[model samples]
Target chain A: MTSSVTASLPRPSPFHLLLAFGSGGLLTLMVDFNGLVGLYATPFYSSWVAHGTGIVAALAFLALLRLRPEAGAGGAKPAAPLWAYLGGVSGALTVILTSTAVNSPLALSGTLALGLAGQVVFSLAADRWGLLGMPVRIPLLRDFAALALIAAGSVIIIFGRGA
Target chain B: MIEAILIATLAGVLVSLSRQINGRLAVSTTPLVASFWNHVVGFAVLTAIGLVIGALWPAGAFSAPWYAYLGGTIGVIFVASGSWLIARIGAINTAMLVIGGQMVFGVALDLVRGAEGHVLASALGVALIIAGAALTQRRR
Candidate 1:
């Protein structure tokens, strides 16, 4: 059992950074596409596209995880209390459900800001608890700050379109 | 144009932060979970803001479509999977593949819709995005 657990954990690979950047780029595209669709169509259509894509992607992730248990286990376990999960789920539901009720641009902006805040909080908690996995490493403070700037930039871009 | 830029910038930051956080958390947690968590948090924060803004400046806030909200769930999953892929591939390689895929997909979508903007402009934007990704990627 112990061996299996260890085997299921992720192993350090040289390709990690590449994977991060590639995935990040793809994610950015997905968000942008969804926002554009939302502007042109009903907010409902945007949700459909985003959710539809997510389902497909999630399935793929599951398949990969099943195929390579070791890779899945590479990171530290979440140190967040159960409430964190609840908070996250509730927050997600609120944003999604309210999208149609709110202005598209403002809604998008709010979502981005909220999402960043959530991640930051979670990261801090994880770091404090030392719950992150073995193979993963949090960015330095400077890197984290840079990331925040990038996120801010994306929000500005979205709003700038006059959508 | 501004919306796209904002979304791009925010997405970039979120992606970077998520990766960093994921690295610290166990690898088993998966990008899906991380993305999910971020979305959850994001949703909560945005909702609060929306409520506040609605109260203060009603004109700025408008009704959203139900479908758009559903997109958040989908986004969460994509982010998670994409992040995991990042760990498997190097940032540059992954960025290349994703950007290429996004371009193909985005162009198809735009063509179907008869969207504005010249092909050249779109291409240029894609190139810039790729370059930005390359800049942010970690060196071995």
Candidate 2:
């Protein structure tokens, strides 16, 4: 994780960046969709266990990565404000909410569509305001129009009958 | 039903915020470090929530498949990648791409599971979203 924070940061090729982003998206999908189905199959109704297991896996990976001489050699700065650390809390809530939503009559795809719409709206605001210490990038009219279309699409996907 | 859907929507907002926060942290530290703090805080919060509910460990959760237990690991990957991408690309672009990816893979999974979907409506929705993403991508 810290490997990318170096002085001589090499620009990743477009292909690599796309691949990375694509993998991130797919992994997120699996975590949400599979995690829900898998956790519900268990006798224990605790969704925390799912998140706990991921922590275990991630810690192991971090431990292994740290063994590499270059892992933290970049000497990158430490963390930002304490509020930044709360990202995980938001994430935990997402897992719990997703678990409940998936089990509800709204079903998986519908729930996912709603989530996507929410993300689009939220991302617009975050980018516009530079929330959470992110770089500010205001959305233009085209961007707003595009987001509206996406929101409309999501509404149709979630509410349109079988057709 | 509507309430659950609302929760899911709210979850999306939280999810986006989490990714942005994690990504901002990653700019200073490694993505792993960013993800580490996230999982630790998340796990602690979940534990606290569970304790309040009087059941931190669900009964018979051990019976779950070895794979089900791997959600956290997959989650790590997602967070790490999102954290890495949000800085390079703007938040909206990153969100668009990630959601695009999710929609594509999600539809495939739904078809495999024989889940009842809106079909034509979903297709239109997907099309519009993709187009929207493309338009938004042009800004940054």
Candidate 3:
């Protein structure tokens, strides 16, 4: 007898969200360390190296994407036009420039706040224009509550005695 | 304290916005492109800002140690990988795993550097962060 296989739709799992936040915190901390290391070693070098590395790493990632199509398994398709991509790029650039211009450390609480604002604006635009692969949801109050907690934790570590 | 508050607020905004964008561009291409584009735009923006502020070619710009640059490259890789993973496993899971991994590595590195205090605080901070993230997880 032959067995039949069915592909089920992906459902949002609480565990996944927890994992994302946990991972995001860890990554942020790691980036912080890297920044510290650069601060002590050589500031300019750090920027140059980071830029160079980004290019090489991004290419590598693209290669990997080509090699392993399964890596993007659960991700949805892009809904917005290509212009959203430009918007995201601009937003990222703006955050970095603003951080540097203000002489605020990357781990600073204020910088993080600015970054979040930028992201929100970009997201809203993408949602409105159907750009990127963003999902369309009502964004209930609970969503804001969750985000508040995340922001609080991030601030505590960056500005508190912890860092 | 004020600085921390600002950063947290910015991060929150970014996360919220990312969610919205994620909805519109549920596919992986947006993030993939965004990651690369972030660098290009970042370089241009920084360069322009530096020039305007007369800090574009600071004394240490070209004289910084080689290792400093190397570390940046590594960071770029991490960010890209992390973004890709976020698309794959959902933002929450990827963020958690990356954070956990970073904590392990960061603590070890700091200990080697003789920064015991920072190591301790970082460890504790990571715990709290992870816990908070857990609370936000979507319910099945």
Candidate 4:
């Protein structure tokens, strides 16, 4: 679980950075829509519906990518280990756990903030050790500095919500 | 309180773990393919649970505004992009940048919806977030 952090730092390309950031925007939208579903039904029902739709959407996207201008989903690739295919189980479990926590005294704001902390901590270790087959990256002083600023801003936004 | 905190935190952990695992699959297959598997597998599991619990058709779920159902479509792209980004940028950068984006965009969404909040705090928070993102984009 613990591996020595890498020594050197490599900058992310501009394109990759944009994609990552843009995807975050997509997340906000996803959460908003999914939460609406939850409000109408149970969170479990909400998640189940989303996943059901997601499967159909994924198929559409895969077809588009395969047919279009420059997408490359072709070429035979190695068969994924069984464990690699279990990401959805992790995702499904998240919905249940989060639903329960949100119903608790922690509420949405607290749950969001704590979830942020968990994500940050886990990713730090993930980058440090290259957990789950990612490239190892040792966060440097600059990285910590950036994190501090983002964390502060996030805390303010989260706790400062709704009047 | 403690239980809530732990569960909330664990939920976050699972979010990252799911991405990491999907990313690994993406390494072998394309990110889109990984995302497909993610949705299909997740749908299957949820279906089983829904069957067992018999709560699949809970009241009012169907009447949710049409737009709500679109979240699943958006999620396919979101999960695919996360898988792609994690393998390319490493997890920390991906997480930081994505969270920053979500926060910034969330505030924007709130503003457009005319949601109430402390304006000064919102501005300050946004400023800090942009600055943090700039720091992230700094040349290594």
Candidate 5:
């Protein structure tokens, strides 16, 4: 079941593109706010606070969603395994590791560059192997082109800020 | 230097790892449900670490402006969006597009705040990223 080859889905619609981009923008804002919190409090505290607040926000949104049932909500999904819920552990560890790297000789720029590389490598592998229960996708040529351009652009932005 | 580099790279890997895990949960449940668990569980773990290390209540922990505390609110939406996108677009597309957006938006944010930097390099970087995004939109 895990090794099944699923055909590539239709290309992402423009709406998905927009949402993905907007999500990244949300990330910028999140880092900005959390970074501020970190300055006054500990990094752990900042993350903890974000997670705590996230719980409230999620609960509120979940409640609101309950009021209005979604259209085509679809049939019941298979239950997620216990380990599927451990994503937070990976996230918490990221904070600890990243903070340690930021203070090292790598500084912010080095860390950013290397982190970008790491993400690219892992994401490619994730898709190739369908790791972690996601679907498998045979990356097309355009995918590599996209990755190169974005990675190049991100690196420039990272180093250019120092200029 | 080596250890730090490895750690930084590992951190990035974990970013994808976290997203992948949460994405799985989102598949079984809704994205928002997965995000909720991600945050609450993270909160629990961090709280334990903070207590163990005696860093739970730092100096002036509550002194931040009210708006500064809103990251998690945005985060709920952000994580949910990633979970939703990854399944549809696959991990690489999701990661690339989002990274592009973050870089482009970061420069825009800096500019908005009147931050200092070489505008030329930023422009070049933004152009490259935009071109890259266009490639994804192109249907063969």
Candidate 6:
């Protein structure tokens, strides 16, 4: 109920961390794919409708969690900026834009590949410039190399689809 | 193709930005509360757009599969978990891990669906992504 039972455990081991991070990524992509597929399949259901429905589901889940009194252990940290609260707007934009693009000739893998490129670029920039109040990190040479590898890998995955 | 690329790229940026914002918000509020606000605001924004265009729900909306409506639910989890993970592992590290995991899962999905994609190429890409993620891990 409290988001995760893992939350109360000791600091996660490396394996636990890996599982959490990877699972989060996988879940995100699955949702994206599902939403896109649904949007394309039903002309009557706009991206808005699909997204709105998903929100309803999430709220329902949250409500169920709240019914469990044992599930509320996440202590709130210090207050964040008002901008932090605006994430939902950007999230809506992501859903709409992605749904539209994927429905186009770009296809799923291709659209995902391009999106990955953008994600990597924006993530690196965020770290480098401390944008969005994230901590600044001076990327190492290896970091650059890593980014390049990721980019190449994504391209291969997209073009390799041979569609 | 070009338009798709542009839209995808923009969407990617928005996704990253949204994740960052949600991460910070989670720090101040519980992840559930943060997630709720995210959906509430997102729904509001989309409703506003639908209003501007004069229609919130297109006809035949009831016909879409139940799974399609799960994106928002999945998204709530992504934001909540991402918010938690990013705080622990820093943004870049978290991003790398997520990307790596997502690519692997995507490839698996394609394979399972028997999509006629290039398996070898996707394998290589997944490998590179994993390697990149490992390399980016901060040297303790």
lDDT of 4 by residue, B1-140 (tens): 88899999999999999999999998888888888889988999888988998979999979889999999999999999999888877787888888888988999998999898887888898899878878877465
Off by over 4 Å in 6: A1-17, A36-46, A60-76, A100-110, B1-5, B138-140
Query: In candidate 1, which residue ranges exceed 4 Å CA deviation?
Result: A1-163, B1-11, B23-28, B51-67, B91-96, B120-140
Tell me the number of clashing residue pairs for each predicted model: 69, 6, 52, 0, 0, 1
| Tens-digit lDDT track of model 2 for B24-120 | 7788777777787788898789788777876665555566556656666777777888888788766776776666555555555666777886777
Could you give the DockQ of candidate 2?
0.51
What is the C-alpha DockQ of each candidate? 0.14, 0.51, 0.29, 0.71, 0.74, 0.51
Please list the C-alpha lDDT of all candidates, in the order they appear. 0.44, 0.69, 0.46, 0.86, 0.88, 0.69
Shift in Å, residue B14, candidate 5: 0.5
Over the stretch A104-140, how does candidate 5's per-residue lDDT look in tens digits? Answer: 9999889989999889999999998999899888777
Residue clash pairs of candidate 5: none
* Comparison by DockQ, 4 against 5, better one: 5
Candidate number of the best DockQ: 5
Please report how far candidate 2 places residue A15 from its true position, in Å: 4.3
lDDT of 6 by residue, B87-110 (tens): 565566566677767767778878
What order do you get sorting by TM-score, best first? 5, 4, 6, 2, 3, 1
User: Each model's TM-score?
Assistant: 0.42, 0.77, 0.57, 0.93, 0.94, 0.80
Model 5 Cα lDDT, one tens digit per residue, B1-140: 99999999999999999999999998988898889889988988998988899888899799988999999999999999999999889898898899999999999999999898878899999999988888887365
Off by over 4 Å in 2: A1-46, A67-79, A99-114, A159-163, B1-8, B136-140
* Residue A64 shift from truth in candidate 2, angstroms: 4.3
What are the per-residue Cα lDDT tens digits for candidate 6 across A9-87? 2233466458655665657565655556555553223456645665676668777777321243345546567788798
| Each prediction's fraction of true contacts recovered | 0.14, 0.63, 0.28, 0.81, 0.84, 0.59
- The number of the candidate with the highest lDDT is 5
Q: What are the per-residue Cα lDDT tens digits for candidate 2 across A1-163?
A: 3433321122234543465547645664656545554555531233466567667777788888763212532565654777877888898788678867878886766777778878888998887788878877766556567657766765675565333
Candidate 5, overall lDDT? 0.88
